[model samples]
Target: MSTIIYPAPIFGPVHSRRLGVSLGINLLPGDGKFCTFDCIYCECGYNKDFRPKQKVQTREAVREALEKRLAEMKENGPFPDVLTFAGNGEPTANPYFPEIIEDTLALRDKYFPNAKVSVLSNATLIHNPKVFAALNKVDNNILKLDTVDMDYIRTVDRPTGHYEVENIIEGLKAFKGNLIIQTIFMKGTTEDGKDVDNTSDKYVLPWLEVVKQINPRQVMIYTIDRETPDQKLKKATKEELDRIARLVEEAGIKASASY
Candidate 1:
């Protein structure tokens, strides 16, 4: 069976197990996709050979669309539970990310007071002071940290030249107790067909160190539910996820698994 793909600026008020009835706000280009990491498990498909030419949507454009959608939804009776900043790629990569957050907050207050503003970032741009400040403002600051081991991180996330695992972890630590760390667990084959699984003690031990350092409010542990570009990839079982969650909680951190 073919995988379901949702592509558009305001694609869905879809049911999300984590976020719940989210009204998606895609900051990246509608036609073109731009991302810092080119992971094998990307649901948007693998990053293309050429760089995305189109720029991210402006703050005004995002705000206007959100306001209009909220107004329409209100009149229609039921509205989304959250206004999620998720799209083709990393939402924080936009240069005007802070301004966008500010505008979204304002719009949320005005139109849908009950709705919360959430951002799904790769945590690559958290190293930037401005980006960090912006992320701190959101109701749900969902940041990704797949692994802490440099070799495993490189193999899993496949981040760009500018991004360093140490730098990303440092940025995350700077957030202290204010953030939510999201880890997507998977057992897959690398592009070259090498076995990739971080559930083992050796791979997860380093990640636990980072978790202790950051001390986030919550740690979301989940495995792949959708088709990825790499056909050889396999999803981790519920029992495996539960075991990892137990380890995380044993370390005095809150963990939730989505199997």
Candidate 2:
């Protein structure tokens, strides 16, 4: 199966469907993937399929690369709308992630102060105090919450290590409306022939309840856009995504749907 393995430290001034003109900040190695979760839908593919020989990028390397990229962008054109920490694997998994965030913020201020700094994390490591603090500092702390059901999680998300949805919800609550909740709604069957449609009320309602409890600034509901590792999976229809977005909107929260 085809997959994307992004270069470490910095990449792109690529247009993002959600964030817009995003400058990617990849903390994981360029060669392969390293993540806490092994979601079937991941564009980077399964962890076992693409293992990195190189270690995670260091704090200094991240800072330097980001600075260089920012300088070039400043000198040329296509200024970034957001410096996004999303590529390959989980950004917070990097040992120097917090420090890198600090560096990124400083550089952003020096170059594009108006631009936002965003991190796309799986919400698995928020239990770590340092990771929590770092997330709090960013302009957009976007955390993934596909569903609350453990069965669904195991079937689709398939967390590699210890991951409890209850714990994740609590950690999200601790954010106190500072974070953005990103959810993927899809319709499909896993390779094992088990159904995996999460757009239904069975998944949406319970997930929405937790979203309300978390009280995030916004909820980004999206379907599969690019090619996923799992060929059996299908994108959630625009109508279904809209319905969920409306539910979130009705709850007095801002919601965006990307089909």
Give the candidate number with the greatest TM-score: 2
In candidate 1, which residue ranges exceed 4 Å CA deviation?
A: 1-8, 49-53
Candidate 2 lDDT score relative to the true structure:
0.94
RMSD of each: 1.8, 0.6
Lowest lDDT 10-mer window, candidate 2?
1-10
lDDT of 1 by residue, 22-91 (tens): 9998888776567888777887776674346666788888778878888898899468899898877888
- TM-score list, all predictions: 0.94, 0.99
- Model 1 TM-score, 2 decimals: 0.94
Cα error, candidate 2, residue 41 (Å): 0.4
Model 1, backbone clash pairs (residues 3+ apart or across chains), number: 0
- In model 1, the clashing pairs are none
After the best TM-score superposition of candidate 2, give how far the Cα of residue 157 lies from its true spot, in angstroms: 0.7
10 residues in a row with least lDDT, candidate 1: 1-10
